[model samples]
Target: MRTEFNWHLTAWKSLGRPSPGDIIWETELLNHSELVMRKRAYQNSTLYATFPRDPCDSYVHCGGNGNSVLNSSLICQCLKRFVPGSLENWNLKDFLKGCVRRKPFSCRNDGFAKYLQLKLLDTTHNWINKSKNLVECMAKCLSNCSCSAYTDIDVRGRGSSSAIWFE
Candidate 1:
């Protein structure tokens, strides 16, 4: 018997347990929806791995205000309504400095974009409003000129948590 866990599963019944192997095999999907399997490691001597989880799992892997989309050729991409800071870098595979707003926020005419299936970013520059509902949280975030994004994060027992980020 092998204990295998899959980190990404779109549905429950669709789940398939990985087989136990001293040699680990992992798949990394590229931009064109092509799947490439790479031998990650041998579970001998020590068991450990590296960061970014994969090339696509790094914070701002696509640069500032940019997102690293999984299974895409241009993994790092500016969020909706934004443009890359350096188009040359973006095309040349250098995603260090992420993105810039397409239109400057008047603060009065700005709206929030909804995103799904993402890992929580680092909370170093976040503001937590525990009591606010999603609408209230959006309003709270809207008042601050620096608030770049907001979300209602669920906290199992404690309920939903309002998290806002300043890019």
Candidate 2:
């Protein structure tokens, strides 16, 4: 079944105050994820910003464990040691199935993969400890059978939250 969703646009001059602008526009397309603009008397609409400025900017564009590469026809690829869950679907430009580990995880030898310069996954339901360093975080995550990913919240090398996720 096909599901329909709606996205509403609104402008605010200040907190809880609506703007009485003459025109406001926001649009999304295949090439451009989003475009927003505003217009007033005798003037062309001024574009605010174009979303997905980079191919990677689009939310989960490459699905889990996939990387979105800019300026490439083959935009998405599975991470190292992972393979497309559905190879046929991936080749057909459908990545919703995401990627899967090439081999089943072994607790005795399993370890986290270091992905640099990545926008971490959602943390709403993940575990977090503010007083842990990266080494401590890794140790904690490694001890848990369910832990899937882990990282130090602050990237500056200073002590920060240890964020961990479970599958």
**TM-score of each candidate structure, all chains considered together:** 0.64, 0.69
- Among all windows of 10 consecutive residues in model 2, the one with the lowest summed lDDT is 1-10
Q: How accurate is candidate 1 locally (lDDT)?
A: 0.66
lDDT, model 2: 0.75
For 49-108, candidate 2 gives per-residue lDDT tens digits of 666577688767888888887787888988888999899999999987878999998877
Clashes of 1: 4
Whole-model Cα lDDT per candidate? 0.66, 0.75
Per-candidate RMSD, Å: 9.6, 7.5
Count of backbone collisions within predicted model 2: 0
Instruction: Provide the lDDT at 106 for model 2.
Output: 84
Clashing pairs for model 1 are 31-72, 31-73, 63-98, 64-98
| lDDT (Cα, tens digit) per residue for candidate 1, span 1-167 | 11353332122222384454333333333321222223334433332343345767655566667777778877877878889898888889898877888998777787787777666666768878777767788878888888888888765645457888985
